[model samples]
Target: MKKYLIVGCGFSGAVVAEQLTKNENCKILVIDERSHIGGNCYSERDPNTNVMVHKYGPHIFNTSNKKVWDYINQFCEMMPFVNRVKTVYDGQIFSMPINLHTINQFFNKNFNPKEAEEFIEKQADKSISEPKNFEEQALKFIGKDLYQAFFYGYTKKQWGCEPKDLPASILKRLPVRFNYEDNYYSNIYQGIPRNGYTEIFRKMLSHPNIEIKLQTKFNESFNIDNFEHIYYTGPIDAFFNYKYGRLGYRTVYFERGEEIGDFQGNAVINYAEENVPYTRVHEHKHFTPWENHEKTIYFKEFSKETGNNDEPYYPKRLEEDLYKLELYLKEVEELKRYTFLGRLATYRYLNMDQVIEEALKIINE
Candidate 1:
């Protein structure tokens, strides 16, 4: 039987390892620098509150892919979840994604669905035949005041770049509703895995042919050349030894505090004001809304430039990163025996469902 090396035990690696082991006669060696599985989405029972907390940050599983949903469901039961996000601007609370009710309430109008749609259109920049950038894109569709109120400051803080510098593609298809629906995602299939994500990792790697090495770093002595292929889920630039400059990534920091009662009314709350240092606050207990908790664990998320010590969270794929990425691609083509997988390897922001779906495609290929 042939053997393959899977580097990084993220969802991408886990799904691929499981599928390849079942579909082909391949022995798998899964490795991760982290002590546990599930990558950034790793969850465990919070010692403080006895609730399964999102370790690095909150990861809500929202995707419309049925196959991807079904595939994960086989490993662990999924509890229904709707990501109801809130936002605080100028010390006032509002539903995020700027839904119909938000519009009416913000403007102090009593518009219904039809009136709300017309109102948004009136607010939109009708003269803009084409949107030049992220700012223009939002203004063209949603109007200037709304953009200023909801997006402008928040985006500048989150990305550390003017929305005008960003590609209009970034704002494409941001969830906005004509109705009062504030569920962050409109996916037909949405939920949190019943057990923590670690349990899901356990099921994915349960096959006899798989060997997992946690806290193991891959060096020349690892003998990856002996294997038929290498599945790399680590950062693309790091994989090639930064042969091509470096791809930029935004690292995040979280400040936590225990709240005896509800910290915030929702699971995710966006701090849209630029004055606010942190981007969002996550109320962990609200994640498992099926069960209630007396105490809540919350995180105030702050983003920073990624360093060697800091774990890469969000890929800052600007024009400069794209230039570096081209060089990385050339280097990837020069490699001997490896296949890049997932958002990290590809340097794209991908959701959990997309990762699972992509892994299935890779296995079939």
Candidate 2:
């Protein structure tokens, strides 16, 4: 019988394991450092409120690819959801993604779509023919006022640096809309699973050929000679024991609370002001509006530099980080028995659909 080992049982590892099980006379072992199967996308019902709380943070599955969409739906029923995000800036609530409604509210003008476009053109920095960084990109696209109100403080808090220090490509895609459309994501399919994300992972890893171990951390000393091949979804830097220095990452910690009736009355609300501290407050109950609950649970999420003990969330991918990543890739190329996959392994910020697509491609190859 063929044997395989998978480290970190997130979507990437779980999808690969499930696909591999179709092979005859094969057995797979999956392990995660965390006690749970679903990595950051883990969700469970609160015993007190019976609300499905997004333990790591809210994850709404959205993808433009029909193949990816259908692939995930095989595990669980996806409740139709459209994320209409809201932001609080200067003591006012406005629709997010800086739509025409947000534009009118911020400028205090009732300009039509065409007039709004013209006004934004005038507001944009005319001197900047090419944006050099994130700050310049925002100013060129939405002007100083909108940039200051929406992108400036939030970007600083989330990334742990000034927007100017970041790369221009981060904001390359235009973030504003000329119409009143405020759907946070422009994906063709968007929803939260009816049975929660954990169930989806549970179903995927339940194949008879697969065995799982929780709280099992993999390191260089772990025995790998027994397995035919190994799929690692953990951080690439940690795999090399930080020999080239740790790649920069920003991690998030949450302050959770429970309230009766409703807390924010919405799934997510961004606190755009730097003075507010927390980047966003998410009420988990609002995520599943199809279910009724008297009490709601909310989390105040704060971003900071990832420490040794922290679970790294977002990859900073600064210039120095990229240099270190290149070195790690070189070392990875020399290893024939190990394959690195997923967000932390690749050191790239990927959506759920993108991660699944990458995992499927690897199995196909």
Candidate 3:
């Protein structure tokens, strides 16, 4: 029989624990500092409205990988969901991802798909053969007008840095559509768990050979010799006691309030103006369209540089941070009986499906 200690009971840890438990000789222990199972993906019913509220933020399960989708579906029922995000700029609402409808509406011109594509190509900066930064990428892709309206302000607020300062890779994640298709993601499968993400995690860890310890923090006090292997899903820098200083990260603060009926008639609305304090507002009730509620709960998301006391959300993997990360990786290689899992452990921004896929790969290896 073998014993494993899995730190941080998030999707990565839970998935690994579930896979390991398939072997009768394997026993697993999962621990999390937060008194919940799903990590940042944790969701629960709002006491007042009885609507499922995404505690940290809204996490819509979307992935093109059928294997990942089928693996997760085994634990919980997934309701079909389409994320149609909207952006507010200059007191006007527009469809996000710069679709053809958005272009026609924004410029007050009726242009078909081919016309729109040609227009954008002319607007793009043809002189720049290669985009070296985020600003250059935007200007090269859709020109200045579209970039300023949708990307500039929103990206500045979201990353707490100017677009020019960020990497070109950041803008590559976004798409420019020539049609009216406004679905936020191009994934083949997209949905939300019917019972909430917390339930999914609960079911994943229900095996007889698994033990869960909530509110338990992994620190120096825990003896490493006790377990055959350690699966750490926390911050890699923190695990080594900040021997090479902490890696940079951007954390979000949510300003929550309850309102009668729908707040914005949409799941998410982005405030694409730098003057506005918060980056976006999330209407939680709209997230779970299967259920209805009289009162709605929403959150005004504010992003800032993470501090020692704050929980790190998005990894700010700038050039300096990558240098620090490399140092941490060297230390990781020297260690024994330990494996890093998930976003924080690897210090990379990964979606839920990617995290699960990585977990499954590691366990199979």
List candidate 2 stretches off by more than 4 Å.
none
Clashing residue pairs, backbone N/CA/C < 3 A, model 2: none
In order, the Cα lDDT scores of the candidates are 0.87, 0.93, 0.92
lDDT of 1 by residue, 1-365 (tens): 89899999999999999999888888999999889998998999888887788899988787888888889899998998888788888778888778987888789899888988898889899888888789889989889888998898888887878899988878876566889888788889888987778899999999999999999987656776678889999888877678777788888899988879898778899989899999999888888877778888889999788888899888877889999998888888888788898989999999889998999998898
lDDT of model 3, residue 195? 86
lDDT of predicted model 2: 0.93
Off by over 4 Å in 1: none
Model 1 lDDT-worst window of ten:
217-226
Cα-based TM-score, every candidate? 0.96, 0.99, 0.98
The CA root-mean-square deviation of candidate 1, after full C-alpha superposition on the true structure, stands at: 1.4
Residue 253 accuracy (lDDT) in model 1: 90
Q: Which tens-of-lDDT digit does each residue in 1-365 have in candidate 3?
A: 78999999889999999999985578899999998898999999989999998999989999989999999999999999999999999989999878999999998999999999999899999988889999998899888998998889988998988999998877665588999999999999999999899999989999989999999989999876869999999999999999998999999999988999988999999999999999999998898888879999999999999999999999988899999999999999988889998999999899999999999999999
RMSD of each: 1.4, 0.9, 0.9
Q: Candidate 2, residues 1-365: lDDT per residue as tens digits?
A: 88999999899999999999965579999999999999998989899999998899889999999989999999999999989899999999999989999999999999999999999999999898899999999898889999999999999999989999998978868778899999999999999999899999999998888999999989977888889999999999999999999999999999989988998888999999999999999998888989999888899999999999999998988899999999999999999998999999999999999999999999999
